[model samples]
Target: MIHNPNNILTAGKPLEEATKVMVMVHGRGGSARDMLSLSTYINDKDFAFVAPEASQHTWYPYSFLQPLQQNEPYLSSALNVLEMLRARLQSDFNLKPSQIYWLGFSQGACLTLEFLARNPMRYGGIFGLSGGLIGPEGTSRDYAGSFEQTPVFLGCSDTDAHIPKGRVLETEAVYQRMGADVTAKLYPGFPHTINEDELKIVNSLISGQ
Candidate 1:
């Protein structure tokens, strides 16, 4: 198992009869509480929010731009943490895969997106803020399985110093190939941070019809 410890931050209805659950992931140097704070803007009492912190405020040791293996045991371990959370949510609250959401920012966003791609399922939705799939310049992305029509939102700056626009497009393509309903937005002159517009869209996604 990955050696990193997890700090889980929870909010809302405590998983009891909640229609939706959002697993928020923080960026490097940020805590789970930092991500969970986003729930305040969402403010949906019926939906539960959970954020799991990385052992050292960072999921992996190297840039996600490196080769998959180069990120080391941390990458695999981070994925394992998500898997464990999913299993617990399923057994404890009888939550269907379709009722769970994955949300992340920056490095956390990269991790969440890669995890969903590797373990494709019918999640309620996926919100990736300032991030894309992990890999070097020409990493092969031969993933399988459909998202079963899950909605995926990819919001990023056109000139994000940390993330390349090409990778964002590639990530969108991968999700589309997996049968996901994808909505991608590239903000002009935005920085390497989440913006209000992105939060507005996220709110709409979680409060679907």
Candidate 2:
């Protein structure tokens, strides 16, 4: 099922009974099961979690900073998977955009931010861990639509080898321009891993506090 949306893993509350839903995306080389582990930290008992596995556990073949076309059909396919999942949640579960949230790490984070920017709306919240928007520095961000004040959090290491702090800042600016309530933080000299402080923030966001 390469690039297919059928390979999905779910946890937390059953979809029929869930009041909130969070779509979690794993990074390159990561699996749906790995992404589901985050629910342990999210600790949102009422949330229904959905995680889609990518082909070969990777979203795109090339680096996100590479020219957009270089990522080709894989990038587009990955985005489409998200679209399908969103529609599924809405139609099947009677969930609204405001009842859904998104979280991703590294490559997954890039895709998450790109999707939100391309399809702007008011979501429960968005959390990008250790990542930034896709494409090189000069990629045109002329994306249309507004987030309508959706809460977005982006956290990364200042010296991350894969994600540059500059890109993280640029992503924050872009989301802000699109009317998202964005919060971005750079941990000085930190490793390329999620930190407890970030989890705290996520819990707070999930709690709507």
TM-score of each: 0.96, 0.98
- Model 2 clash pairs are none
Candidate 2 residue spans exceeding 4 A from truth: none
Candidate 1 Cα deviation (angstroms), residue 151: 0.7
Candidate 1 residue-wise lDDT, 1-209, digit = tens: 55343458788777886888999999999988888888888856778998888987889999999988888889998888888888878888999999898999999999999999998989999999999999998888998899988989999999999999899999999999999999999999999988999999988877773
Summarize candidate 2's per-residue lDDT along 140-199 as a digit string, tens digits.
Answer: 999999989988999999999999899999999999999999989999999988899999
Lowest lDDT 10-residue stretch of candidate 1? 1-10
Q: Of the candidates shown, which would achieve the greatest lDDT relative to the real structure?
A: 2
